[model samples]
Target: MFQHSRLTEFLLGLFAATSILAPSAAHALGGDGDKVVARVVTFGGACEKCDLSGRRMSGAQILGANFSGAALVGSDMRSVRVLGANFSGADLSRADLTDSEMIGSNFSNANLSNARLRGVQARGVAFSSAIMVKADLRDTEAQGANFSRADLSSAQFNDTSLQGAVLSRVDGRGASFRDAALQGANLSSGRFDRAIFVDASMDGAVLNGGQFDGADFRDASLHRAALFGADLSGARNLDQDQINHACSDASTRLPKGLVPRTCRGVTPHWSPKAPPAPPAPPAPPRP
Candidate 1:
């Protein structure tokens, strides 16, 4: 009888200990199976190759974080501030970063397919060679950002600011830049076939050797834009007045009855005007 009583006491003690330790363990090592569901608010320092797939990290501040090659697929990262972070080679497919601020971040070679980047402020971000197919970048301000050699097929850039951004050698087929600002942006050697540039400002933009076959340029401002050796034979809504505003060469293919002017020693009709500044980003989250 005494032995039975002792066993019951031991079992109760064990249960009490487990109850106390379980919460701490779960808090310290938060995960369900192979996936980790972190409840961290501010993310800093390095977490290279971390798997943060499907996590809800909205309004999180990622300051100077190195999340290179991390898996952030389908993550909810809306209103997140990613300052000076290294996200190179990261898988961010289908991630929602709407209204986020990503200043001076490097996303080179990252997979951003179908990502929602609406109203994002991405100044000076490097997205070279990134796969951004069908990404929604509407109303984004990506000035001076490098998107060189990136695949932006069918992506949306409506009302976006890409002023002075480098997009050389990009495959932007069927992409829409309606009412977007592309002043002084480098689109040289890029394939933008079937893309829409309706009402977009392309002043001083470099489109040399680019392919714009079947692309729409209706009412797009091309003042001082360079189109040397560009293929726009099948372009739609390209008026002679627009052609006169742009600097083109004999090698520039145009629609029927449209002639291109030589670029040598010809002065621009109007001075370059800068686009309106983007809205101020939200303040960073407190520590």
Candidate 2:
């Protein structure tokens, strides 16, 4: 009888312990079986060519890290702070980076196609030569960022702020910049056929030698914008008043009956304001 009682007590204790530890173990392993949880919270140092595809790294801090050529496709990296990180040549396609802060980061030649970057703060970041086709960048603040020669075809930049941004030679065919702030941004020598710029503020923007065939410019402000050598003959919704506000030269191809004016002493209508503060960092995960 005593032996049986002892055996029963041991089994009961074992069951209790297992029940207590099971939940914690599952939580540590990321309760969901579909997503792989990241082992570390903070990422730094060089992790070049690392494959981190489909990892759940929301709110991660990746300061000064070198993740060049890494694969981060389909990762959930929302609200991540990646200051000064080098992500050049990385494949971040279909990744969710909404409300993230990536100031001064280098993403040159990276593949960010179909990525979600809404509300991202990317001041001074370099996205030159990156393939961003069909990427969603609505409400993004990218002042002074370099996007020169990027493939931004069919991308969404509605209500985005690209003040002083370098977008020279970008392939922006079928891209939308509706209500965007592109003051002093450089779109020189780029292809923007069928692109939408409705109600956009493009004051002082340089569009020299760019293609704007079939592009929409309805209610867009072009105060002091440079249109020298730009092809706007096939553009839609461009009125005489808007043309008078812009600086155009003889090389600028405009719609019939619109005269080109020189850019001398033109007063800009839009005033520049300081960018808004970045969003707060995400809270730490539960222990």
Candidate 3:
């Protein structure tokens, strides 16, 4: 039963708080202002949890901000400069973070299930043991990010780049990776049951001792990818051309196909954007 004046003030404050953009490194930012906290306390921080859902705090500088264990469910923190921000055990489920920068942010043990993070630059962020089930991460950049022991079931990564990201011991059942680039990504001991990888680029990625039950690898590149002792049983649509391109070994068992001889080492897969061919000489068109 908030009055009209209260609602107007609350909306104004919320809008003012969620409009800051951050940087692209894992370091604490420099901004000592109480602008964001005051806004949060007014609108959403009722008793225990803050309901800053869809608050457009894009590109705000909130370095060293202690949000550890804070409930930021469905917050819109796009392009925020929050280096070394402590978000440990925070609940950021279903948050919208398009084009945001969350470098060096600590989301350890956070619940980010159903979060929409298209085109976010989250390099070097820590999400150890975090749960990101059904998260939408299309066209995002999460290089050097750590997701060790995270639960990522049904996560989508369309056209995303995760070069050198660590996702060891992850639960990624029914995940989709259409046109994603995962070069040098580490996914050892991950559960890929029913995961879809349509047109994914996994060059030099690590998948040691993983579970790939009901996984789809249509047009996926795995060049130099390691899958030592990985269980690829029930993996479908892994054709010979794709196998030869990505270097699979004796461990990669298809439904019923001859073990490839040319693929002893890791496979030969292409990256998302291959080096452009040398530009042809400027042609002098004669009429």
Candidate order by decreasing TM-score? 2, 1, 3
Instruction: Report every candidate's CA lDDT.
Output: 0.82, 0.83, 0.68
Error of 2 at 159 (Å): 0.6
Model 3's number of clashes is 31
**C-alpha RMSD values across all candidates:** 11.5, 11.1, 14.3
Question: Model 3 residue 101 lDDT?
Answer: 67
Against the hidden reference, what TM-scores do the models get? Answer: 0.80, 0.81, 0.72
Residues 76-110 of candidate 1: C-alpha lDDT, one tens digit per residue: 78888788778999999999999999887889999
TM-score of 3: 0.72
Model 2, 177-258: lDDT tens per residue? Answer: 9999999899999999999999999998989999999999999999899999999999999998999989998999998888
Candidate with top TM-score is 2
